[model samples]
Target chain A: MRTIKLTLNGTSVSREIEDNRLLVEFLREDMKLTGTKESCGVGVCGACTVLLDGTPISACLALAVHADGRAVTTIEGIADGDRLHPLQESFLRHGGFQCGICTPGQILAAKALLDANPHPTRAEIQHWMMGNLCRCTGYYKIIESIAAAAGAE
Target chain B: MVPFTYLEPASLDEALALLAEHGEDAKLIAGGTGLVNLMKQRLVRPDFVIGLRAIRALAGISEKDGLRIGALATIQSLEVSELVRRHAPLLAEACGHVATVRVRSMATLGGAMAHGDPNLDTPPALIAMDGQIVARTRRGERTIPVDRFFTGYFGTVLERDEIVTELLIPKQPAGSGTAFLKFLPATQDDYATVSVATRIALGADGTIREARVALGAAAMVPVRARMVEAALSGKASDEKTLGDAAPLVVDAIDPIADFRGSAEYKREMAVVHVRRALVEAAAKAKEAR
Candidate 1:
């Protein structure tokens, strides 16, 4: 076991976790931050996408110890108090999700994209969000949502 | 994943000492995009997991006579680095096409090399550019040419105590043009059915002065198309010259049949892609000249 101190969702937190604990397991199981989902445990599916130092990474592929002294942003941290983040609002406004399983990852991944390029083109959005799979096949809506969010900003 | 003790070494010396002490019992973890998955599948169960992220020395991209890419540098960093794009545009192009933005953000070039996965896009690009893998151990440092670095599937010539420190990629010759083509019949992010990277340098007279060709996901290891390169040497960069030489790649590759393609299908695709890559690179070389 090792003690890792990191800033999670803008709040400083310290925890003693198993060395083998993955970032996804640490968030969902230990910290109760279930907003991050793990699908296709391999890095291909971006269901467990989270922002590490403002960059999107597969939480399932990252160990909690790797988060030490780093900043991690998850879907639970996307909202401003009770008000949903613009991306979240845009997703709902544009019917961006169907089953909602991949919604958190999609939003977080989109958040990282918009943070890097505020005004991404349709092609840019597709390229960035291509890794975050939506089995519900609501991709057109997701694209629209991200575009709308970019425009809203 | 099975339980294992995690060790974080803040310096290269400390990391090397840890490796030398643990020997084969310890596994190095950088970014974890490749190693974590293998551990989850129970393919690699190291008693000690050494985290290399804390070592500040093994990060960043710098240019001297050639590019010095630190092992801890993320693939995303290389994809966006102006120096990388300006000096080795083919490498930047290949890095951009690795998995996705997220994987690129976490996968390091050194980690990718150490992982020794033949299906990866960067190795062929590295091979084409004459990149070298710089490894360090308690004994000393040695440079292994990228083409000869990988011994077999998911294997490298690295010893138990050796750690890849950086990738040294020599700048391409003047009037040289390169192309990286990944044949992805499936999803855009999927590994290539057959990937080819070619570098062609032209003389002032527009004759091919030098040529380098390499392929990934086409063989057990990334194959350097020496025959194709030999065939193109001193020849005019024309369609027929490239066409005749493209088929010579079959002698170097032994692809495995998988869901992406049959071995026969990949061989055929390899020839086709090699021709296309060569043609594109030749055009670029002419423009460069």
Candidate 2:
């Protein structure tokens, strides 16, 4: 087992675990932070996206041990107490989801994109969101939700 | 996925020791795009995963006289980098065409090259740029020029207990232009069927001095067409010359058949991409001159 300490959601947490555990498993099974989903388990489906030191990455592909000394952000961390993040609110208002399994990943992916390029063109948004696939919504509403949020800011 | 013992080495030396101790049973996990997919397929059941994400050696992009891209630099980072866009535009070009935004965010430069998947886009482009692979183990570090790095189908000269640390691309001598083009991912879970990378060096008189033409998914490893290179050498930069040389480009290739296309079809498309890439490269070279 290895010990890892890192800031998650602005709180520093330390834990000891086997080295081979996947970061997604550690977050969901150990920490009970279930906001991050695991869809493909192979890094293709973006359902496992998390911000590792401010960049979005598929946590499923990263070992829990690698998260040592690195910062991580999940969907649970996106909200301000009871108040939802603007991106989350936009996702809700714009019907950015259907079954909701892929929403967390989609929302985070959008956040990363918008944070970097606050006012992405429609085509830029589409290209950036290419990795995060949402099967139920066909991505029309998701793009609109992002465009609306970008416009809001 | 099969059960495995995992270790996240605090330093490169620690990682190399772990790799040396485990040998073939140990595999480095980065970005997880390639290995995790293999795990899902039960194709690889590594008993030990030597995680390098924490090691400082395998991250970030810095430049000197030439571009120095850390092997662990995620494709996403590479695509968004101002340095990459300015120094090695073709790198950004090749990376942008990879799977999608989400995958790029974590897929490392090292993992992609070490995996040596022929269908993957970066190898051919790097090969054309005369890229070099930097690898390290507990013993020491060494470099392999891109052309000498790949051995065969899904094979690389990277030794056990070694991890690729960086991919160094030398500055293009002034008066050179590079272009990379690829067909979309038409097959399920496969690399691009045909991808082409062309680098053209023009003389002051606007004649072609030297050219590099490489194709991926057209051979066991990404192949450099000697015949094509010879045809372009010392030739005037013109449409007819590149067009005439396109067919002979495949003389050096021996493609394998898969669901993407028949071997014959892949070779024919290789000709098309090579021709297209050459024409584009020639035009860009002329513009640069």
Candidate 3:
């Protein structure tokens, strides 16, 4: 086991975790932040996407110990207490999800894209969100959500 | 994943000490995007995982006589690095297409090369650019040419006690152009069915002065199509010549039948992509002149 200290959801979190524990497990089981889902643990599906130091990374493949002294922002951290983030509101407004299992990852990945390129073109949005697969929505609404959020932000 | 002792060394000396102590029992993990997945599948079970993430010296992009890409530099950094874009755009383009944004943010260039996966996108690009892998151990430092790095499937010349520290890619010569072409029949993020990377240096006379052609997913390792290169050198970069030279790649590659395609189909596609890559690179070389 190893002890790691990290800023999670804008709060510093220090915890003891097994060396093999994945960041997804640390966020869901240990920190009780089940907002991040691990549908495809192999990093192909971006269902476990989270912001590490403001960059999108696969939490499933990352070891919790590797998150030491870093900042992690999950789906749970995006809203401002009773108020939804622009991305969350945009996603909801645009009906960006049907199954909703892939919504968190889609929003997080979109957030990273907009953070890096605020005014990305539709092509850029498609290119960036290619990894976050949403079988139900057909990805049109997700793209609209990101584009809308980009304008609002 | 199987339980293992995690050791994060603060310095290169400490990491080398741990490797020297554990030897074959230790696995050096950078980014952990590749090694961890293998561990999860029970494909690789190491008693000790030496995390290289803490070694801050192993992450940066610098250029002198050539480009020095730190071993821990993420693929996403390479994709956006202006230095890499100016020096080696082929690498940047290849890195941009690897897996996805999230995976690229966590996958390191050195880790990708050390992983020695034939389906990977960077190996052919690096091999075509004549890159070198720098490895270090308590014994000393050694440089292995990227062309000679991979030994077999999921294998390299690296010893258990040695760790890859950086990748040194020399600047391209004048009048040289490079192209990396990947044939992804499925999703955008899927591994290429057959990928080709070509570097063509044109002479003042408009003939191919020198050529390097490498293919990914062609064999157990990234195949340097030397026969194709030899056939094109000193020849005019024209349609007939390329058509003749393209078929020679089949002689150099031994592809396996997988879900991507049959071995026979891949060999045929290799010829097509090699031809296209060489043609595109030749055009760029002409433009550079």
DockQ of each: 0.90, 0.51, 0.90
Tens digits of per-residue lDDT, candidate 3, B152-240, equal: 99999999889999999998888998899999988998999999999999999999999999999999999899999998889998878
- Output the TM-score of candidate 3: 0.99
Q: Model 2: per-residue lDDT, tens digit, B107-222?
A: 88899999888778888888888899999877789989887888888789999878899999998867888899886656222368888999999999888899998888788888
Lowest lDDT sum, 10 consecutive residues, model 3 chain A, at: A133-142
Quality of candidate 1 docking, DockQ: 0.90
Per-residue CA lDDT of model 1 for B101-220, tens digit only, reads 899999999999999899999999999999999999999999999999999999899999999999999978999999999999999999999999999999988999999999999888
Q: Quality of candidate 2's docking, in CAPRI categories? A: medium
Per-model C-alpha lDDT, please?
Answer: 0.94, 0.85, 0.92
RMSD of candidate 2 to the truth, in angstroms, is 2.3
Candidate 3: how many backbone clashes?
0
lDDT of 1 at B229: 98
* Cα deviation of B209, candidate 1, in Å: 0.7
